[model samples]
Target chain A: MALVELHDIRKTYRVGDQEIAALDGITLSIDAGEFLAIIGPSGSGKSTLMHLLGCLDSPTSGSLVIDGVDVSRASSNQLAAMRNAKIGFVFQSFNLLPKFDVLRNVELPMVYAGVPAKVRRERAMAAIERVDLLHRVHNTPLQLSGGQCQRVAIARAIVNDPKIVFADEPTGNLDSHTGEAILTLFRELAESGRTIVIVTHDNGIAARLPRRIEMRDGRIRVGVEAAVSATTPLISPAHPGEEAGA
Target chain B: MNFWFGLLIGLKEISAHKFRSFLTMLGIILGVASLLAMFALTEGVARGMRENLAASGGVERVEINNKDPSEENQDLAFLSPGRTLDDAEALRKGAPLVSLVSPEMNLGNNTAISRSNITIRLATTGACPEYLEVGKYELAEGRMISQIDVDRVTRVVVIGASVAGELWPDTPDYVPLGEVIRINGVPYRIIGTLAYCESDAAKRKRAAGFSAVQDERRTRRMGKKKRVNRYDTYWQKNHAILVPISTLFNDFRTASNADGTPNWKLDRLSISVADLSLFEETLNQVRGVLERTHRGIDDFGFDTREEWFDNIESSVRATRTSGSLIAGISLLVGGIGITNIMLASITERIREIGVRRAIGARQRDIFVQIVVESGVIGFIGGILGLLAATGVIQLLIALSPAENAPVMTLSSVVVSFSFALGIGILSGLYPAWKASTLDPIEALRYG
Candidate 1:
């Protein structure tokens, strides 16, 4: 079953007297362990889509089923619980609590999940260790390098062992090398069987992901190769053989 | 999420801004302290007044005086002829509400001599045993005058503490039990010493000149009367001496002629009513009966400690009004201080509030947290204010004259602390509510 499914989702925001269509009848599905990148230019509604998928917001209309649980009709509190329990979010700005140390920043999601303190500590420490920030556990975000802070953000995202991780320009603030290192972490998380959806406009960043979904003017563009099936033998061979035979 | 954690965070935040927090708390502290101190002073003053009244006589007792216009112009000798021992006896028997009726005949120009020859002006009065109860006099030593003493006209007297100290200063351990003292050159035995009245000093100040003049006028008015040279000298510490009515009348009574004919009758009577609750009723009844017996002579007026107390209360109320006005101003200033501090705190923590809301903290949570923080600061300030008030009370007590010193009561502490806390909460409400209702998005965007 698809880990996440959206049925004809629609979202509209009232900017003054004008109604802006942020999401328009977009139907999409993604399975577990898929590393998909949603690529679009600014004002293309990709961030809004990411917000809905990450459970930070609900679609204005239509049904959304996350892991087979209908989330479109969920209450705010329920959505918060869902976000804390099943979804991890990585913001473009690496939104680490400035007052908290690296370890505490990583442990925050588990804290929100009401995990036992001892268990949260162990899980957070392990997550920090995975991000190679164990030595910087006591250093606040301001004290950490850009890549190190992004790693801490990733560590926080996965510390609760969420079913899906949403990254919105997770490498936006970092240099190319640092950005690559963060992308590697996303790939590692996806390889560990977590569903990863990244939203970014960087083509290089998008190409690195296993599947790329192009969004334009609140709708996904058609006529592109189905990136998810590109690895399957039938599609790759059929496309190349068709071209050769023609 | 846990209460302790929230409290710890709050404490840490408060401590981080120590001076600001202290400044915030200052309003509450001054407000509470002023409230407590003012209340203490008011309570103390009330107590002092009550004590003074009780010493003069319990507030319930009434004094009935002969108020005859005809008698007003009469000489003391003739005036005494109108008031008789019968009036006292009549009040005791006919007035059911009157518990006890003691007729007091004050003798003027008397002298008391101690063993050391110290002469003190005597407060010589002749009354029955009920006089002591009506006057609220406790016998510190020896015994009070009894009915038999009055009937037999015993030459016995009770000395006040001041008089006893003056006459018996050298006798370190001497208890003036059955000691003999000279009254008007006549030897009278000292039977009792009255306990120290709380307002003895005030009475001394009031009586310094007036009492001596009154005595002289009484003496002069009783022309050619057998003037009892009964000296009732009240000491400085022990203000007055009491003598049996018979002794005051017999030894002090003067003759109009050398032939031993009495010059004037002892007619003036002072009646002290028992059970002050019945003072008004008894006074009316006695007045009615006396008016009837004296043939419409409006020669009597009833006086009670309540009248004096009313006068004192009015004066005290004026002082209290001024005090409360001052305290009100102080509280207003304190409240403004609280508002200012809370507004500043809200401004400083806008971002923190935004972050908390972003993390799923509800507006109600934000509201409660701010209010709780303000309340906690208020409570702490209240405690400190109480301590400050207690210190002020102690200082006042130490510095005040013993007789007029005020006391701090438990009610004052509670009232002051609660008022301060209420002020704190009230002052904080607007600022805290303002802070809580800020839009999360806008707040997050705030610098």
Candidate 2:
């Protein structure tokens, strides 16, 4: 079974007596260990879709099965628990708690999960080591570089060993080299059998992933079969034999 | 999620905004201080009054006087002549509530001469042994007049401290015990000297001087009727001699003396009740007894320290009302300031709340966290306020005159501190509630 499944998902928002549809009857499924990118321009409802998929919000009308659990019907508390135990999120702005040190920021999710202090410290340290930020673990967000702060945020997201990791424009705030390094980390996480989903407006970031799902105006442009092109190698240089359009 | 953790966070927040926290606590501080200070002042006054009353006589004692309007209009002749030893005996027999009763007859006399020939006019009262207890007198030397003295009409006397000093100035160390003194050229043996009646002695002296001036004014007002009453003048000057009641009857009574001596009678009877709690009941009972004895004349009236004690409630009430008004205003102002600051804090922490909520914090958790933060501000403020009030009270006590200084007790500190803490918690509730009820999505969207 797919790790995340959306069946006829819909989301609507009320804006001053006007009902704006943010998602319209979207259906998708994501399997385990898939490194997927959802690409769209601003106001294309890609962000809204990401929010629904991350369980930060629910679909107005649809079934959302995350790891075979009906997420759309989950209570607020259940959704919070699911987010803490089953999913991880890394925002574009490197949303590390400004008052917390790198290690503390990484330990936050485990803290919320009521993990024992000893285990939380061990897991948080391991996550920081994974991000190559173990040496800067005592530094607060303000003291860290942009890339380093983003790494801390990523470490915080994954420290609880969540099954699915969601990155929303995760590399948008970084320089090209730093952005490439982040994408490389995502590739490594995916290779290690973690299901990684990246939402980006950058085509370069999207193209670097193994599979791409293009969205426009709250609708999928590439069909599901073509979108999951597993045969295609991620981060591959263009083949000389194939034309650019083909 | 842990209470200690929440408390630590709350304490951190308070430290982060020290000045704001202090201002919020200011109300509690002043409220507690004023409360304690007012209590101290009132307690001091009550204590002073009790001491004064006890010195004069026991607080439980009551004085009863004749209610005759005719007696009021007349001179000492009517007032003193109407009361007699027979009437005193009747009261002793008739009154059931009285534990002890004594009859006293005062003679207006001025001529008192010491063995050394020094003379001073001192007020004198003729009494039995029971007069010692009724007057709350203590003897410095010799013994009070005995029943034998009354029975034999012996010329034995107890002199006041001032009288003793004036009469025996040459021998300052001598206290006149078992010595002879002459009053109106008649010799009497000094039996006892009074102690701790100095204040009353001084007051009597001033009253005598005042009455003399008033008597002179009265003489000027009435030209023909202004006969100089030597007995009245003598009573005004010599106000410190006590003799047996029988002696007063024998030497100074109107019927006994052929020289037309003024009538010496009891004008008033002072009753001492056993228990203060029974004051009203005892007063009513005494009034009923007296009325029955006097044939429902309604000429006499009853007064009690009950009224004085009751008056304390009103004075304390006024103080408390004013205190409460000031405290209420301060708390209201403090509450408003705290709410404003907390609302700002909540607004600033919207994203944090959203983040916490998203990370599995229950609604109750959110609520508890915010409330805890606000309560912490109040608690710290209360402690600070308590310290400030204590310092103020200490300073006030230090600056006060020695006679009126108040001692601050532990009860005052506990009361002030708890009151301040209560105010803080009470003031912080609504704002914390408001913060806790925000929608996570909306909060996350807030700037």
List lDDT for all candidates, in order.
Answer: 0.71, 0.69
List model 1 lDDT by residue over B330-379, tens digit each: 76677778778878888987876755544445555566666666666777
Worst 10 residues of 2 chain B by lDDT: B230-239
Query: Candidate 1, A140: how far from true, in Å?
Result: 5.7
Q: Model 2, B309-372: lDDT tens per residue?
A: 5675577568656865676576556656667777787787778777676555666666777777
Question: What's the distance in Å from true for residue B113, model 1?
Answer: 5.8
TM-score of chain B of each: 0.80, 0.70
Q: Per-residue lDDT for B265 in model 1?
A: 36
Q: Which candidate is the best by DockQ?
A: 2
- Classify candidate 2 by CAPRI docking class: acceptable
Model 2, position B124: C-alpha lDDT score: 67
State each model's C-alpha RMSD to the native. 8.8, 9.5
